[model samples]
Target: MENSTQINTEKINFSLEDLEQDIWVRLVTGAVKSRNPFHTPCVATMDKGEISLRTVVLRKALAKERELRFHTDIRSPKWKELSLNPSISALFYDAGDRIQLRVKGKAVLHYKNDLTAEAWKNTTSSSRRCYLTLHSPSSFAEIPTSGLSEEIEQENFTLAESEMGYSNFGIVSIQVHSIDWLWLNHAGHRRAFFDYTDGSFQWMIP
Candidate 1:
């Protein structure tokens, strides 16, 4: 039989073949989220001369495009910090799998009629619920949380959308500069780093 650890890694698309063909499944299906060791993104930023970190989701990744994306409210604190500084790092951990992907890149925000809107149009309604909240992100509010039910009376699907409420949608696209992927298998532990620059990739071990 194949080494179980190796098989598991492949199952998670940590292997070459999986990475090439199944990365989209790993992201869109939310399959990788549960399989992941880290429950959230360790997004690092500089806040007024001080370093800060927060948990965010991986959002979306287009394997073919070699791009990773995340969503946020324009009014959110992270948004302001990101606007001030475009360079950012996204850290991911998978506790059960002992796998991690640390991504460093220049984050570019997307707004209506630009790259961001195109991304927003692709998001699932479940994810879009976040943009419907009554209050702006990071805003002070009353004690109770009413959830999306109150604001979005109902949800209907469509192939096309309008400007009605799409303005609230914000997408963050990180043009990946480097991805440091590490894994702790049952027997063999390995770390590999890949850097993408100027339409080329450089792979190295660490």
Candidate 2:
């Protein structure tokens, strides 16, 4: 549910420019508000001739640069897959607002770099705990486990202890190329496409 501070930006009278700005507004909101539907988006990538999809938290959105950022474990398959094929897509939807956004881009990984260093410095110990795993994300286990060590699983590690996970932490920056936006309503639906690569935008039949 939207908070009291949320404004009504999905009205039918909205223009293309308004819709584009609203999309960024919602993305920025999702990054800070866990309750927002856009907080988690379905990210798709090409992996060895196959399509891989996963839900990722929206860490940052830069409207001017046409980029979206996410954090990941350097050992994760998604990281390696993206390294092999940078082509990626992201899907976001808000049922309450009846809006959908399909974003296409290329993924750029940052590991042990200044970008990752700054991001790690601002990360909380709890969030950093995700990188303290004993095995890779999809590694097979003899028994069910959280992939994290008992100490990390129990959240007994101190802030300094969490620093060990920083090496496994990495950033995935999506250099957005285009966006397909759709709005559903009882009266009628609206759709539009915006391409940053060529600076082309147009309304489409919904």
Candidate 3:
């Protein structure tokens, strides 16, 4: 779920590497990057004074790059919104650990780029083919179209429609401006933020 970035404007700063690392622990302990594929951070935007968030998967962990990324269909509603307003927030929680993290930043979209294509190529044909079925993600239909339904050839459809769908397959990169982390430990609850926009971090009262 990582996207490549060409312009290096800013890198997100964390208050402390240990706490930041601990948050990662909370994520792993909660199987955040694994089974929680759909537990992706909710990207929110202020749509005419109201807020809306959508589920998105964290596809890649570019820690070294100091970045976080996710993947979604380019035609998805969230994608279109981001296209209009790059500023967005990603929210995640680990129920077992009683921890949550929110990152706010500008979003960039990558589709069919060298890196994106590489990831797409590495994906399983079964999953890769799913993108071929439709252009509009989250679009509703009167009925479901399963690979096993209608005695139709799913593989053939994917292969035949690959080009058309590939254009819409995209990865989203969050240009993290700040990260607000809330964690509960043996001592007490702690909330802190790493603000890259100002190049400083502070621990906040939780």
Which stretches of candidate 1 lie above 4 Å from their native place? 1-40, 122-126, 146-164, 186-188, 198-206
**Poorest stretch of ten by lDDT in candidate 3:** 1-10
Candidate 1: minimum summed lDDT over ten consecutive residues — where? 1-10
How many clashing residue pairs appear in each of the predictions shown? 4, 0, 2
Best by TM-score: 2
**TM-scores vs. true structure, each candidate:** 0.68, 0.93, 0.75
Global CA lDDT computed for model 3: 0.65
Better of 2 and 3 by TM-score: 2
How far residue 203's Cα lies from its native spot in candidate 2, in Å, is: 0.4
C-alpha lDDT of candidate 1 relative to the true structure: 0.63
Q: In candidate 3, which residue pairs get closer than 3 Å at backbone N, Cα or C atoms, i.e. clash? A: 1-59, 1-60
What C-alpha lDDT does candidate 2 achieve relative to the native structure? 0.87
lDDT of 1 by residue, 1-206 (tens): 11113334634335544442332334343323534434357788777887778877776676666667777877678888888988888786656556677878988887675677677667676666667666777777667563445435356534343234476766777777877766776666666656667543333453
Best of the candidates, lDDT: 2
The C-alpha lDDT values of all candidates are: 0.63, 0.87, 0.65
If ranked by lDDT, best first, what sequence of candidates would result?
A: 2, 3, 1
